[model samples]
Target chain A: MSTQIPKNLKYTKEHEWILIEGDTATVGITDFAQSALGDIVFCETPEVGTELAQGKTFGVVESIKSVSDLYSPVSGTVIEKNSDVEGSPEKINSNAYESWLIKVKVKNPGEISQLMTAEAYDQFCQTSA
Target chain B: MTLRTSLYQKHVDLKAKIVDFAGWDMPVQYTSVKDETLAVRKKVGVFDVSHMGEFFAEGPDAIKFIDSLVTNDIASAAMGKAIYSPLCRENGTVVDDLIVYKLAEQKLLICVNASNIQKDFEWMNAHAGKYDVRFTNKSEHYSLLALQGPESEGILKKFIPNLPSLEYYSVWESGQTIIARTGYTGEDGFEIFGSHEYIGKLWDQLIAAGVTPCGLASRDVLRLEVCYPLYGHELNDEITPLDAALAWTVKLNKTSFIGKTALTDYKPKYKLVKLLVEKAIPREGYHVVDENDGVIGVVTSGTMSVVLNQGVAFARISSDKFSKGQNYFIDIRQKKYPATLVTKPFVQGGHK
Candidate 1:
């Protein structure tokens, strides 16, 4: 199954995607990540105002069989935590990229450039699969 | 190399997510486990459970030999009857949970867990002890097609014209097939046992009839939802039957079984209880702690209940944990999630 990687988003090796818009960036797991973690039951995200370091575990997404650590693409402070996704974790299964988990106010916007582009992430998913 | 069942190609053709389960290359799901689980509960679903092992104990002393090894009474099982029990060690610990089918007065067929096929054989052989019976592992000879749900009988009745009056926990032999009205899903279902080639053909027939092929993932969830005791999780060498809440499986009056002496008046220190967590899902080996933050016991089996949409799990807690009537918490990922004590069977059984 081919995973959907949107061109507008930057992705981390941990399969989290960051949509940088000004100082605030929306975060959610990529489609590839959600598919691999089938039938996600719970998503525990870092609370708002929580500081997350680059490549650090900011949250956890639990599937039926296993649990995966959701990492931050860049160092940032959590601006908003999606209560909607928490209430309905299956939303990620329906559309991973659409159900944003959190919005982080990026401390260093320049670090977003270090993440993989949509094309690069798609190729990475292929090789990994 | 992992073993492949007769329905492996069919699962592959359906674009199933295959995974290594008990050293077998089995499909985990075709679509999603949640969807598949719902289908089985609401409508109908078929499962390829051909990996389970089958053994035959045939001789004049078949009843004596089989009864001595298992915890349940073989005398209670008449001809063409199936009985559920655990193969226990001498010390009252379970070696494996299996079902025994009385093929004849001098013959008995046993269905065991796939992973415990070899172990159960070895244990049974060692304990036979001059019972004048021959134990043969016929696991490779049979392939099981589990047609489960409210519509299970309707689906199976289509092909088999002469439907034998098979009751629950009873087997009926019609030519080369053995139709047993038994399943772990707590549903009114049949485990059709036949040759691998025959099973493959039957699988195609079921799929053509629009039956959803469920995977082991959903099977585990469905069984857990009904409070059925799974071998490795709920029962083990160390976990007694009473500890797993399977006291019904142990018949202490059974004639001189392996674990009879030790479990004569056994009272388990741990009690199996169902819990519903707030949001976070509880997993195996997670600590179940008391209100005082002391580790009381551990979660044996856990999953997110599709029907309840909440974290439901079975944990083996100490009897003393409830003496003070304090609530319990499951320590998941270094965080404590409060869990409410609920009755057995996290969901009301939808079985007919």
Candidate 2:
């Protein structure tokens, strides 16, 4: 199935995506990630004010079939979590990018250079599949 | 490496996510578990259950032979009728739970779990040698499809006109297909048994007839919603039917059976109960704890229920510790979530 991957976003090997604007990065799962996980039943995200290092576990995304760990793409402190997900986790299934889990203040702005671009991530997914 | 069923190609064509289940390459989901599960509950859904085993027993002593093997009274089951029974070891421990269909006075058909095909066949054969019965394993030769839902009867009536008349737990042969009003999912459905080659056409016909294709992931959730006991979870060699709350099928009056002696002395120590978690999804092997934070038992099978839209689980808890309306806790990861002990089925989606 074809999934939407915004060109402006950066992705991680773990399938999480970050949309960086200034010092804050909006975090959510990629379309490829949501489709792979199937229906999202529950999402356990890191609380606000929680500090996370690059490549560190930030939360968990659980579907009917399996549970996957959500990794932070960039080092940051969690500033906000999506309260909509707390009420309706299925929002992630509908539009994964729009259903951002957390907004974090980027610890190191240059660290975004290490993340893969949308095209690269799409190619990575194809190779892995 | 595990074996693949004939429908493996169909799963791939549908872009289903395939996973290794009980040493078999099976489709975990086709579209989505939520959609497929809702389809089964509302309309109709077809499933590829060919990985399950089918065995044929026929001869002069067929009835006598099967009666000795299972815990249910096969002699009372009329021709064209099917009964669910448990095959127990000498110690009253459940080896496997199977469905036995009486085809004729001298012939019977047995359906067993996919993983226990080889072992079940060997066990049945060893016991058949002492009697005038013939056992034939036809699991590979046949393919089974389950069409289930409230509207399943309507879809099936388009092909077989008299399908509605077939009573529950009864089997009828219509051409090459043996249609049985039985299914694993707690819904009114038919289990069609036919040759491997023709089964594909039947699946296509059902799809053309508007039956959604379902996979193992939805099937597991559907069964869990109805509180149906799975083989490895609710049953095992160390657990008895009495403990699993399936004593209704065990005929204690039977003079001879594999587990008769042990069953006579069996007492319930642990009982399987259904739990509805308020916040978390309790998975298999998760600890079931009491209100005092003492571990009592472990969860056997659990999933995010589609019908209830909540987490449901079946766990074997101490009989003394289990009580109605009592709140229990399930340890998911490191967090303890409150769960409640309810009736067998967490949801009543018309499986009465």
Candidate 3:
């Protein structure tokens, strides 16, 4: 099934999406990614203030089938972590885009522009599937 | 290429997440594991078990030959009765755990694991010896559907009008189809055995009736919750029936079984026990350690039980007396958490 991808969000090739507001970027997995992972049982994200590099591992998302590494969409310092997601990881499976894992203060604003647009990401998902 | 069952296309249509299980392309889940797990417990669910192998032992000495091969005595079982046993090797370790069905005089049906089909066949053939027993591999000829849960009786009653009710561990053969009141899951269920075409028709009827199509993942969780020992995980070539705490299945007093010699007065060093871990989940191959970091044994099978909503695990620990709430630790990802030894059937199952 084709997953929903908002036109405004920038997507990473690793199936993560980042929503930019000023210099802060709210990052989470896309619907395609969550659907592929099945039911999320446990999610472990980096603590607040943790430094992350672009395309680097920042957390882990585990499902009943397998565990996947959550990668950072952009280089930044995590300003906020979603404790609710850590408590109940099913939020990501139910509402992936809204279940933002972390809020990062972007180290490089230009990196957001380099990510794939909604149309490109949608095509990429189809090709991958 | 991975082998696909007759219902393989159906699982694909249901958007089931397919995984390679024992050289067969099988569905792990359709919607989600937890949801399917719940469906089997609360409502009704169906599992395509076509990969499981079936063999027949017929002729004059079928019962005697089968009894010599398995840990459980087959001669005592009445016709239409099924008995569970560990098909053991000479060293008393499990070759595979299977169910033997007693049919008309001198006829028996053996249900073996999919992964161990060829091995079991070869082993049984090698021991055929002087007995007038014929071993016929009927695995490819039959397709199996396990209709499980509390509502299984009602769903099963639709097609099987004659079979009003079945007692536990019993079988009723109606022409080519065999309905067994048995299941790996602790639910009140029935295993329907028929040809691929017949099973396909039954699968369509169940699907159209809005019955939940479950996968192997939910089946594993359900069986684990009931403390059923999976073949590869709990009983393997190296792990004996006594070590796996399946001593009840092993009747050493019987004339002479395959593993009876080694099993005489067997006191196992390692014992399988259920552990309820706090917070963290324990997976297979994780260490079951003590306070001083001594690795007592290893975890065999485990999962986050959906019914209990907690981490439940089964481990094979040494016989050092850790019963009645004796504490231990499970080494998961280099961190140790306190766990307690508990009895089985972690969640209550079945209409019985």
Candidate 4:
């Protein structure tokens, strides 16, 4: 299956994607994560104002068959939590890139440089598969 | 090394996700687990269950010999009828649950769980010394395909147009093929047991006819929703039939079975109960706690119910420590999620 990796986004090895806008970063799982997890039934995201550490678990995404931990790509504090995805987790399965889970104010800008580019992420997924 | 089924290539051709199941490389999903689950609930789905074990018993004393081993009275089961029973050890604990199909007065077929194939065969064979009977392990020679859901009968009619409707738990045999109106998904379905060559052809025909191919992940969700007992999850050597809410399957009055003496007065210390959790999902090994947060049980099997859009589980709780009117909660990740006790079969299907 071909996964969507937006050209404008940066990715983590854990399959999370981030779209930077100024100092804030919008975070969500990649298309590969959603398809791999199957139909997501429940999503638990950290509330706004919650602090996040880079590569640390901040949320959980549960599908019918399995549960996955959502890791933060960059250390920051959660400024927005997507209640829309919380109410309807299936949205992530439908359009993962569009269903952003959180928005964070970047704690350390250096972490952004450590993440993967779209092309690199595509290659990573291929090698892993 | 893991074993592969005859249809392993076919599953790969269909782009199925393979997983190691009981030492066998089996398909866990073709599309998505939820989609395949709904297909079986609302439409038709085909499943490859050839990993299950099959044993045949043939002799002039077949009925009596088989009847002496199981808890159920298979001697009374009419020809072409299938009987479900538990093979128990001397201590009244279950070894394996199997289906006994009486083909004739001198012949019968026994189907068991995949993981328990060798154990079940050895247990049965060791006890068959005195009876004039012959047993053969024929699991590798056959393939089992289950056509399940509300649309199953309609789709099967396209293949066997002239065949009559089979009653529940009834088998229709023609040569080496046996089609039984039996399934684990609680749906109006038929389990077709035949040679691998015939099953492979039928699988292609069904797929060409647009029937969805389901896998083990969906099968687990479907069976759990219907409150069916899985072998390793709900049943084990330590669990008795009474503990698993399968008392009806144990006919204690039958003319002296293996566990008759022990099961005659058996009272289970633990009882399995169904729970409905709307907020959080409970998984295996999760603790079941009471209102005071005291642990009282453990979850055996659980999943997100697609039909109810909630979490459902089977928990084995201490019989004396829990009450029907009291509040129960499942401890998931150190958080207590309230659980409501529900009746058998969290979802009803089209089956009788």
Candidate 5:
């Protein structure tokens, strides 16, 4: 079953969710992504000062079953990292959107246009399934 | 194009993730390996081990015939008792490690790995010409299930009324089913052997009684936690039972047997050691390196442990290369990560 995606957020084809509010965008994995990964055992996040390009793998999330890379949705500098997620990665499986991994300061706000809308992402997941 | 077991439909019905392992379609996991591992440790869980092979040996000289093949003393085993033994070649190399259950003086049951079933049967039958014993490969006709955990006894007692009274490493036959209080997992469990037709019903009965259905993923982690030697990992054709630290099972005091001469003259150059990596997870085929960045050995089985929450691996390293508390490096994709050699069973005594 497909999970409900927030209408205001943008999504990536790699199953990452981006919540843009002003110059800073919060990024986390989708609920569908966490369920597919099973229990989250460990997470490796990029450094706070590291700069990432859009569609580039910045970190990795390892669950009990498999390990998946987390791709950056917008090209920017990572301003904040989730310390809570580093300690207890299982929080991502419980609430993916609330447990944001990184908050990146947007370098070019126009890059958000490349992400799919909520309706588009829902249809994309359906077709892929 | 791998062989599927009889419980293939049941596994698919439970939404299990299936994978091809050693030429058999097996369930890797049903929900999560971590949760299933914890369940078996604290409560109860059941596994579908029908892919394993079972054989029956009968006749007057069954004990004599089997004693000559395996490294263990099968003649000393009383009826209703089981002993783990290794079948070796003339060159002191292990063919397969098996559990031989003595049902009576003339009847014995042997459980072997699925991949080596045919070869092991051929080896046993070839040597049966002198003895009155006859070997039969009953793998296709039997299904094996393991009910393991601390609460396994309570759950199993509901079906088999006398199950809780049976001692460890003992076998009791109930009609067509053979119930043995032994399992690969380091827990208080029982391995039930019976026909495939009745196993589905038994599985449903256990599920109805609140026993969780676990898959091979959890089974591997459970066995690893106890430092049990797997076939491809710790035991292989080139490695002798003595080299793998399984010399306790080998009875060299006995009379002539296969590999006895070579085993007496053999001196192991390398030994198996459990390596614990901090922060860095070592995987299978990963090179084990020394302080000078010289490769010494390779990792056989590795995984991110749920209990330890770190990377644990079992590797065969040069005996004189490293000692306890000596640090080494594992080349994980060109990055040399730090690791240390520790004793087997990263986790200490729970059950065996």
Candidate 6:
């Protein structure tokens, strides 16, 4: 709950955040998610041009002790994938927002309404915690 | 509520993430498992292994009584030396694997896993009816600290100056304190045992000397990299030492031991093998398959190695199904990832 929840971004219940710019959106895990997962050692993200469906697993993030599925928050085509984060996953631990995992071209803008705002996401995290 | 060790408050002060391990509220990691693990491999790190159980076997028949219950030649083991053995059941399955320190001919100290304390005590007492040995569960009276890594000796020498003379798997007594050159991390280090008050003081001293405080998470990664066996993971009540590829710990030539008769006729069903996994990181309970995707075994322990920068695991492959130079795959979440069966010790250790 103490982690930052930037107001301009949209959030998913799985703790992924979205930064919408025009018709494309940059996606990454929230600071809260990164902290909860501990030290991430490996990240497997969908390659560019791969189709992603909302609420489905597009990849995985592995910590030293556990592995978590990375859920795609919005349905779209993967335009760009962060290879730096894949090679050095600890960047997500240092700054999850800045270490965006993928950039997707929006397929359905209606899914954006289903995503929670920063305040709503904060309340969700508190209740789940 | 879980049990807490004497250093619980210290771990809290260091902001360690706590988890219930073997019924104890133990620290799993402080900063990260990767950092703590690397610190022990490169520098020095201290672990609060006080939750481990300790027992005392002392009497005129202590050596004979203890030797009869385990699968090692404890009776012939020299004084001041420690012998690792598997306490086996009558059927040759392991009851628990423990380290027995031969302090004197009539006095020995036994250390068991924390979760197996009660079960091991009951098992030992049931078998000690004929021998004149007195078994004392002294687990509550002791606290153990493992100071490990390449720089461990230099740091620990600050307190115990005579630490240089202690040989590996040997115990040195200093009044009521016991310092043994033994650790699970595969790093050259010492395991210090003493009362709660004395151990608390020693912990503070080691921390002040700039030793990294490690947790159970790093400890597992370190041990697995060295191919050391853990009770619940690589070993269990239903698995014999031979089945787990711990035949070295079983002295078959010994005249008489608990499971000697059964173990002599034992045929291995499972061959514990190490794997260097590709693609996905394998976890416990993951099925291991052959080229045709036929399930052959299950992974007991798996982790992403900080040193190797890859996923590594230990799996119990069916002996009849396994063949030398044959290919293997680990099935993870409906996907089969290619796994190469590798030799032991996934990482080179610093042990002397």
Q: Indicate which candidate wins on lDDT.
A: 6
The true-versus-predicted C-alpha distance at residue B48 of model 1, in Å, is: 0.8
Residues B237-343, candidate 3, lDDT per residue (tens digit)? 88799999899999987989998998996678778988888676778888998888888888898887888877788899878744445568999767798877876
Scored by lDDT, model 2 comes in at 0.88
- Using DockQ, give the best candidate's number: 4
Better of 1 and 6 by DockQ: 6
Q: Write one digit per residue (lDDT tens) for candidate 4, span B1-352.
A: 9988888999999999999999999999998988899999999999999999989999987888899999888999889898999999877899999999888889899989999999999999998888889988999999999999989888998987866788888888788888888888989899989999999998999999999999999999999999999989889999788888889999977879888888888879788999999998888899999989999999999999988999999999998887768889999878899999987689987796
What's the TM-score, to 2 decimals, of chain B in model 6? 0.98
Q: Give the DockQ of candidate 1.
A: 0.75
Residue A33 accuracy (lDDT) in model 2:
89
Docking class of 3: medium
The better-scoring model by lDDT among 2 and 4 is 4
State residue B76's C-alpha deviation in candidate 3, in Å.
1.6
RMSD of 1: 1.6
| lDDT accuracy of residue B109 in candidate 1 | 83
Once model 2 is optimally superposed onto the true structure by TM-score, how far is the C-alpha of residue B81 displaced, in angstroms?
1.6
Clashes of 6: 0
Separate DockQ for every predicted complex: 0.75, 0.76, 0.50, 0.84, 0.39, 0.76
Candidate 5: clashing pairs of residues: none
Candidate 2 to truth, TM: 0.95
Model 3, position B202, has a per-residue lDDT of 90
Report each candidate's C-alpha RMSD, comma-separated, in the order given. Answer: 1.6, 1.9, 2.3, 1.4, 3.0, 1.7
Q: What order do you get sorting by DockQ, best first? A: 4, 6, 2, 1, 3, 5
For model 5 chain B, the run of ten residues with the poorest summed lDDT = B343-352
- The local lDDT score (0 to 100) that residue B76 gets in candidate 6 is 87
Measured with C-alpha atoms, the lDDT of residue B305 in candidate 5 is 76
Give the higher-TM-score candidate: 5 or 6. 6
- Give the lowest summed-lDDT range of ten residues in model 2 chain B: B343-352
Those runs of model 4 whose alpha carbons end farther than 4 Å from true positions after fitting are none
Error of 6 at B116 (Å): 0.8
- The regions of model 3 sitting more than 4 angstroms off are A53-56, A107-115, B265-269, B318-326
Per-residue lDDT of model 6, residues B6-26, tens digit only: 989999999998999999999
